[model samples]
Target: MARKSLFITAIVAVMVLGFAVSAYAIGPVYITWNAGGANAGTGGPHQDYRLTTEKCAVCHSVHAAAVSNAAAGEFGPDPIGAAETQLLLRSSVADACTYCHITTNVSGLQIYNGVASNYTTDDQYGHNGSTSAECADCHAVHGADTFKGFIAGKILKAQGNLVSNVSGGVQTEAAATLNTLVSGGTVFTAPAASDGDYQVTAFCTRCHKTFSDASETTITAGGYFEEWDGSVTFGSRSYKNHPLKAAEATFVASGANYSGRVAWADAYTCRSCHAAGNNRVSTSYGGPGGLVSWSFPHWTNGNAQFLVSGWGVSDANIGLGTSGANTGKPSGSHTVMDGAEDGVCLRCHTNGSSGPPNNATAGVNVTF
Candidate 1:
């Protein structure tokens, strides 16, 4: 009887070992926001991070799903089947994001206030249009092939194809195709400390095509794009217009007189100058005026017209050295002024002994 018991124990051990090895071989499983948790069906305050499970029911169900296409409804039906788009619980990708992103309750990633203000009202604040903007339009919920910031598709391509891909034209390409066209186009699998500005520019160029063209020279229209490019050369010098991507690297390496107030290494992205709660914004911008709760780059406080407080060109406090206190709110227009100190142009470029080349007070102006 004892020998029989020992033999059974050995068999059981082998089965358990085999199961563990098989699980390890399968590798890490990725989950989404809506599935596999104690709070799965409870709704409203959704989880901030992804869960781990094989259940697609988080965002979809095999049967008894929602029937309505209403924006306020919890789920929308998939006509084809549950497998199609994974039987998405919402009508569309944008709706899924809105279900949680629109809120005044500070629990979830609140981008817009559903009760007070929303994306529909503040259309100019982000990538909104007559049609509701899709979150998947800009971000890949699962992952991207070449980009690391959860970018949805490829915006970087050969210089020849740059305009076509960005100007409301091609939009995105497959990872393999994108890699074949552009050098160093492989996805940055690892998370980097800084949001890649080069990639960020490509992302923005998808919609704002004319403003991102590097070859543009009109000074009135295409100049903004060129200025952001920072690599454009004129005569013998590479014009450092506000410094981005490699141009920023050159500036920082040159040991130019940076304010040392903002950490330039981390503040190189488009959001650095534009997002709410940025260090550059003055505290006097007022309550909830220049403040956005979510950290995502696409969202910002409605005030200051998307530009941080201290950086507005038309602020009543400009040149008064008052930091725009009680200066009212931003116009929400893209208008910029020449040689304006209150705007973002002077945050890094001041005449505080740094002198010319790096300092804008030496005659450089970013107004448009």
Candidate 2:
């Protein structure tokens, strides 16, 4: 009798546990299918391609392409100029990009470089008012596969000159040649310096010729080498920059905050310091009228050199005392950072208050 009672209790407990498990089970997520509509399939802002022909309709109109600037949408206000070459919604390549890439657009990434949604040609902060390259110049709308010398993949359309091959410390350029942006949508991070080609870095150097390792010899320019071993002298002091791709152990002595400050162990990368998001707005650092006003596209501020976040030093704040640099005001002419602290540099180098002494010391003054 006792054994039977114990068995019955065990069976009841198992049944209750099983019911709980079944109730909390999660189902698989399904991608929405396209049914002959613009951007109808599994396409979101950045993922606006590859699913169906309807996606192309989002930018192109077969016969009913209007001439007036209609309101914004997946099929927004039509282009203002004459009919585009390939049924594009906008007459110019940059106009079509600005149409959807605005903040008020119904869908797509908002990479507008102006205060308002419309195109602001006088934008002085980032890469907005350029007469040179347009949006289509850098990225492939239809996805570049075979048009270029090499496909960097992920929709990056190579426009300018870039280092195509890097072998045995030798670099080669593919000038005006085609190449694609490397990596896919899901995972984007700074490739290690040991990554032979430094594909992502090479992609950026396509236009920003000064930032490539290939230009290190002739050019004392700002590139991978400049960040790793170069020094930028400001006023009376010379500052050493953080290494772009160095061993993780180099920062082992930095302290517990080191890991938290940098997401990757291989130090900083182009993407590590630069990215697009709401936090990178102009007002966050300073308003448009303020000394540190910023614009998007290349993520640069007035005088901040396009740092993702930090105190931007304008001509007004260049040679100010600690009170000036700390308060964002200009006063007497003083050397840079006369004991003044900056949030940008301090993100990695602590203020020597907590654990280890700050590593940003150079003889006397703190050099970022």
Candidate 3:
């Protein structure tokens, strides 16, 4: 009986060892957002970073092609990588993101990095620029929801009042909250009442903090002016500024065209100008232009302002004034003063004047 038991134990040990070795050689499995098994039917809030065990291997190698660095939880001593150790497949964040985003996946949808042909122009590239931004700069790779609740899609790291205002090397402003945005949809609409402040606006302000300040004086107080929220008496002209944050009801009542503007979920957030390419379905401004068709705060026709397309020198008859619409042809000149009645502006305000609207103008100047 003892001899028989010893023989059975040896056979069982061999089988287990062989199975482990086979599993190790097979590489790692990749799971889609809606794959079968325990993770089937999982939604976006918890999809990318939660319960999806296979997803981790897609980006990271547990035992990378290098000596192990047990201290940093990564394979260490890799000459071509970072010291802190992310164990990324590619050396840098940009390369890894562009590897997938730059091309069309099996789904046939290009999310971040468009095809090379479509993104040929200077303004066509947003965060894809080599020096501009990386995927990790915005997105949370290993999952942002620490408390087992849905955060926003693309997993925005912070929301609500957690705006970043770093000045003189220290964060001068109050630290903004984290993960307050807990809603997701085709369009990033309003969240639950208890979620937080206007998340999209606050998220943008994390980098573009100048826009968050209420006063232009404070925004440009350093003597170098940044005309983000409209300027005050700079270079002999005053551009009519739009409100960055405000109640949608009040803004619509104050008169700027909200028709076909999708980002106006609850308030006039930063997304009003800087949003996804397809969000603007309005045909008012000679259909959507190429520059506007790309995501904002990234691609901008080399203009640096990141203003959407239709900003070119073309007259658009928006039926704003009692006078007939400008429609086609230059009713106004292309001089710097009038901005040639750019269609980008007309997309919102009725054609106010031959020149940029003054503070007295009711169409562009709506008080919150």
Taken over the whole model, the C-alpha lDDT of each candidate is: 0.35, 0.34, 0.35
Candidate 3 has a TM-score of 0.47
User: How do the residues 156-266 of candidate 3 rate in per-residue lDDT, one tens digit apiece?
Assistant: 544322222432111122122223233532112334433323444444544444343122323321111335354422222222234444323333323545532221222
Residue pairs in clash, model 3: 123-301, 126-298, 162-176, 162-177, 317-326, 317-327
* Candidate 2 lDDT tens digits, 1-368: 99999999999999999998888653221122222245433323234355543445545555434445533332344335443433545344446655444532233223443233223453323455364345565566765331222222234544333233321111233221112222322112223322313444445544443332221234322222223323332222122333344323223332333432221122223433332111121121122212221222343333233333222222112211112211232232222221122433433343232212434332113432
Worst 10 residues of 1 by lDDT: 278-287
lDDT by residue for model 1 (77-147), tens: 22322222324354344355454345422222344434323555445354442343455665544332324
Count backbone clashes in candidate 1: 2
Every model's TM-score? 0.44, 0.44, 0.47
Model 3 stretches with alpha carbons more than 4 Å out: 1-26, 29-52, 63-92, 106-109, 116-125, 145-151, 159-164, 167-197, 212-242, 245-267, 279-293, 296-306, 309-341, 351-368
lDDT against true structure, model 1: 0.35
Model 3, 274: alpha-carbon shift in Å?
Answer: 3.6
